[model samples]
Each structure stands twice: as C-alpha cells, then as structure tokens.
Target: MEVVRSSIVLSRGRSRLTVTGVLTGLLLTLSVPAALPESGAVTPERGSAYMGMGVLAHDGIARGATADSLPDSRTGQTEGVDVSSYQRDVAWSTLYGSGVRWAYTKATEGTSYKNAYFTQQYTGSYDVGIVRGAYHFATPDSTGGAAQADYFVNHGGGWSADGKTLPGVLDIEWNPYGGDCYGKSKSQMVTWIRDFLNRYKARTGRAAVIYTATNWWTQCTGNYSGFGATNPLWIARYASTPGTLPAGWAYYTMWQYTSTGKTVGDHDRFNGGTTQLKTFASG
Candidate 1:
C-alpha cells in the first residue's frame, strides 16, 4: 500500500515539513522523551538487551552448536532459563511449573543501561521458587571494567550467600555494536575482564560467573585460561552440547543450550543437581 502524500512543504533555510507532518511530529515529540539518543551510540530501551542478542544479531543464528553435537545424556541436570528486558514480565510461574529451577536476568550494561524489568524478572522468579541472579552485558569500549562492574552491582547484580540468590554473571561476548571483543586486543580484553572480576569479588565476596561462547573466548581473549580457576562458567551455545568450552574449565556450571527455548526464555541446564546448585549459589 502506497502512502498518500499531499501537503504543501514549508520552504526555508531551516528545513522542509508538510503541514500534516508538523502535527504528527509535534505529537511524537511531546510523547517521546528528549533524553533518548537518536543515534546508535547509545544503548536502546532499558532491559531491551538480552544475553545472546548480539550473538544471534551479529553472528548468524545458525553459527553455533548443532544437533549432532549434543551430549549422550542430560540426566539429573537441573532445568534453567535466562531472561532480559527483551522478554518483559516473563511467565515465572509458568516456567516454574515447567521445571525451570534457575534463572539469570539482565541487570546492567556498560556503565549506563540497567534493565528496567530487573525487579519483575529477578524477584518474580525467586517468588516462584526459582533460584535467580542478575547479569551484566560488558561493553569494554564504553567504560573500564571496574566502572561497569560497579554499575552492575549497584543496579542489580549484587550477590549474597542466600540459597535463592546466585552470583552475578559477566556477559562478555561478541560486540553487538562493532568489532568483536569490543576492539580490545587479547591482552587488553583480559585485563578489562580481570578488573571487573576483581572488583566484583571485592564487593560481593563471590566470583561472578563468566558467560561466553567458545569461539568468542578464543577469539577475544586468545584462548586465555586464567579465569577458569576462580569463576564458574556459564557456557552459551545454540548447539546440542555446550561445545568445547573456552580454554579454562574442565566442566561447565550452566549451559545455555538454545536462544529459542521451549517455553518463555532461553533455555539452560545446570550441570549439577539441587544440592550442587545450592552449594554453588551459597559460595
């Protein structure tokens, strides 16, 4: 359907706007916040960014794990899911009924954006018996690791020994806005991540979980294995198995198996059972 455009265009050094266009623009301006940046330099609506949004956006959805890569068994693994502002007001009760015992909610990004739905997604899951925690989408190009870590914890990523609250996660992956690794060389990238992890540990007394894909960790950090000793790994792979984890760990704590989950959000599997999961959370 073609839009009908029949209006006199105002001519001046200022610009050109049809009489009808003026009314529409006025209404839009009045309703929209002037604070929102009109360019790509700023983060989008609060909570809109989710884990793997960049993975599926910049890297094709088909890039990761394949069906043949699945493990022979997933027996006794705890069901889990991850959510962000992208899935506003998730069906926590529904997910709980479906056996999703754990969840991670996007809490902050860089030093700026914070998930607007942190409360609903974070606390709601807890209320429904889901052990829950928050995550920070790292943007090394935008701020120092310590700053971003501070912002994340201050906003929603803080951890406690409570059995219901899992440690925060550091979502470091392909840069959705630009080059992979946020344009940092392997050494610099590793340094930034160290800053974040150190600050996070100082603040919360728990090493935040490191969430990344094998390819990303290899590419961005040059296959650095230093972090595996301290931080638990939450491996992301759209494939069957978490697929050859980044250089460090012998095992993965949680595996985000698919971005398109069976139920509400991205599906994951805890590598352990109830007691193990609680122990991991408490520590």
Candidate 2:
C-alpha cells in the first residue's frame, strides 16, 4: 500500500460510488448512498455500506483446517457473479434471468492488459438492473500502486448509487513477478493498500474495497486496523462450507465460497451470499 490522504461521501440512492481525489495506478474502493426507494424500487440504507463489497487484496494463502459449514441456499436472487475477458461472449440476458442481482467485471491492468468484456458488462449489467462493480489485478513488482489506481479510475468508468457504487477492488492474487512480490513482506504491501485507498478516496469521495484470497490475507495482509470502519471486505475461499474465517480475520460482508460456480451467466468463480442486500438498499 502507498501513502496518501482521502475522504469519502456515500450516496443514499441508486447504490453507486463516486470520488473526488487524485487518481492513481493502484486498485482501490469507492462508495455512495442509495436514494429513497420508489414504487417497485429498493432504497439503500442511509449512510450504510455493505460488507461483502470488500475485495481480497491478494491471493489465497489460507492454511489449516477449514471452519464448519453454514447452511447456504443454492438458488437465490441476491447472489452475484464476477466475470472477466474470457467470459465476455456469454450473453448478459442469461445473467438477468438467472437471478444474478449484482455483478463485478474485470476492467484493466498494466498498460496493455484490459478485460475485453468490461464495456459490455458495465452497460449490460446496468441495463439489466444488476448492481455492478469493477476490479483490477495488482502486482507489487509490476506497475506502482498509484499507477494502477489511475488506470482503474480512468478506465473502470463511473459509479452511481445512493449507498455505494460497486466497490473498486484491487485483486492481489498471484504475482506474475516472483520473489517478495508473492512472499512475506507486509510493509510494502500495506503501504500500497493505504496509498491506493487514499488516492481513490480523494478522487472518488468514497471508501474503496479491497479484494483478496484467504491464504494471502494471512501470508501478506495481517490485521490492518488502519482501514477504519468505512472499508468493506470481499474474501475468496474455495471451500465446502462458508462461515467465519480465521480467528484474526474479521466478518466479511461477502464470501466467495466456491470458484467452480455453476451459475447461469458466469464461468468458474467464487460464489457467496447476499443476505443483507435488501438492508443495503433500505433507507
């Protein structure tokens, strides 16, 4: 994480995120307040943010025994999907009918890397009325954190919401650059996260989400209390059951329980619950 300063303004309608600070190259988060509900529409909670919007800032480094399984519903409308360039060809209408109420599409990475489907997915998800967010995969060795943040804010497009825009996330998973980029060294990583968050907050007027895998949480990112209350978390763990994570880990709003998800509009990806979605939409 790099070092920067910022403030956030949450929307209470439309569930979109916005910002007003200098954009950087690192991945980050943004939020908004949902507007009061109208007929046939859901209203977002005033000044409330969803926990599932949190993104894992790194790859899976979780070890040891998994927790006991929690009762999970196989079919529902609130649960969402994550798609990338590979799945661009999939029809968006299939997702709308399949109960995908929300979605996050991969936008871009580095100078040359871009998710081919982001443009279509962003518009398609909005048209279908599914809450949508964007994410960028960041590497410690590749572009600097600020650079990645700039790419995301500039290319990831805009957010519109009363509670929050789909969270801007930094996917800190596998590092294409070997060495410490994937090994132990919290100082630089934490600095990178903080920097990204600060720059994004300054530019977006909202807190940014951090996405990462369970294994990476323990291996790289430890208890980062500095994130404060505004930051939400998204945890990725491919497991048989979903519940509390490790003792050091806090409660996540969204849990990616499975990667090989059999969803209507998505390929193999993490699947999780959206129990509080209505709450986030309530005024």
Candidate 3:
C-alpha cells in the first residue's frame, strides 16, 4: 500500500496539489453550485489515473474526454479525500485552504488490521476543521460482518453526533496481493459485503456506505435491490467526464473520479464529488 502513494505522484505539479493532513485553524465553508471545467480536448492529465509506490494503475473513463463532456456536473458539491497510513506524515494543515471540505480516514482493515494512522489522520483532519469519516477495508477472511463491526466500533473510534466521524465505509476491492482474494468471485464478495454491512449497521445504528467501482456494482453487486435505500453508495470510477450510473445506482451519494488529487496531507490521493461531503456530514 505504501508503494501506491509514490506511483500516484509522478509529477511535481501533481505533488504540490496533494492535500496535507495538518490543518491551520481555518473554517470550512459549505459552498454550493460548484464550477465545472470547460469541455476541452481530453488530455492525459484530465483522465483518471492511479499511482502508488509500486502500483501504476489507470482506469480512465475515457482516453481523452473533457470534464464538461461527463454525464454529471461535479458542481455545487463538497470535495474531499480518502486517506490511510500511506500518507501519514504529510501536513494536513494545507487542506484547510485547498478547497477540501471533507475527508475519510482509514480506520481498520479486515477484523484485525488496524490502521496505524487512524488516530493521526482522523484527529488531524478534525483539527484542520474538515468534516471527516472513518472507513474500513472489507475482507472475507475475517470473522465476517458482525465481527468486523465489533472491531470497527471498539477500535476504529466511536462515531460523532455531528456525523463527522460518519457511519463508516466498507472498501470492497480486488486484492492482487497474496491472499484468498487473488480472484474472488463477484457473488461471493457481495455476500460477504452485505454480511458486513448488516452487522455494522446493527452495531453502530448507522448505515454503512459502500465504496466500490462501477464495474463492481454492475458485475458483482448488481442486485442493488438487496443493498436497500439506507445503504448509501460511494462509487469510484476514473473517468474524465462524470455521469450517473443505472437506476440500481440511484443509491449513490458520492463519486470518486480523480486520483491525481493533491492536498495538504495527501499527495496524489483519490478525490470525489463535493456533494458527498455535504451529504455525509449534512453540513
């Protein structure tokens, strides 16, 4: 995971754009009607791309499409970052003035892999005045749904009344690393995800958001009917133009479309719809 950060920052300009975790006592403003970049020619920089220390991945929605060409306009929404220990030491203070209103800190992984940077990232984000939430990486190997919920509540820090800590998230993605996840079937993965959400909500009294890709929803968790309304969706797609998915995707509340996201604490991290920040925190 550490290597992924390095890969994301291929250029110095990109590095400068990353948000740091340390804040400088700035109040976050809730702005509406955000601006959309003009529909210009698609360039390599405008497309979706992901880079980690050793992970050079690209899932560009279109090879060279401009922003205005995308389906949904990312205007009038809150923009933010999802971070982990990978960018631990980065200064979070920079986010305050960098157009970031919300952040999601990785709190745990599986049932036992606690993120070492949770305290720093979570508190740091809060201190900087950015509305933030805690997230967990889902895995089938652990004690499963209910068990994972226990780990998150007990170890991932309690939720906040202001909803800053958020209802939490379940990151279900393909693991290329050495594990039972080398190539887990989509159905099997969705079953485990639902189990985890069921237990997580039961324990926290809050709905858990699903952070996944368009492909994941269509291929693995196609039955949006099963996930239900209370379960908010956080869709991740690396596309130049943004748009809504199918009806089953109506539950979606956030969309992550950029990876060259440079902020104060996080350099070359993932970025998403600004509306998500407002909706998650109801700010």
- Best model per lDDT: 1
lDDT of 3 by residue, 1-283 (tens): 1212434432321232232222223321111111122254122221121122101121333455333332333355555667766556546677657666677777776666777767887888888887778777665654566677778778773565574556687766433232324244657666777778877777767778777655445555554456745677776654543345533546456665544333333221123454455455642
Q: What are the clashing pairs of model 1?
A: 47-85, 65-239
Give the C-alpha lDDT of model 1: 0.74
Write one digit per residue (lDDT tens) for candidate 2, span 1-283: 1222243222222132322221111111222222233365443322121212222112221233222231135443255667665454546666666555677777766534667667887778767666677777665565567777777788883444543346577666534334424444677777887777777777666566666655555556664555636666666653444444533336665555433211222211223345355344221
Write down the TM-score of every candidate.
Answer: 0.79, 0.64, 0.68
TM-score for candidate 2, residues paired by index: 0.64
Give the poorly placed runs of model 3, Cα more than 4 Å off. Answer: 1-61, 65-74, 178-187, 222-224, 243-247, 261-279
Error of 2 at 105 (Å): 0.2
C-alpha local distance difference test of each model: 0.74, 0.50, 0.53
Candidate 1 error regions (>4 Å): 1-47, 57-74, 261-263
Q: Best by TM-score, which number? A: 1
Worst 10 residues of 1 by lDDT: 24-33
Report the number of clashing residue pairs per model.
2, 86, 45
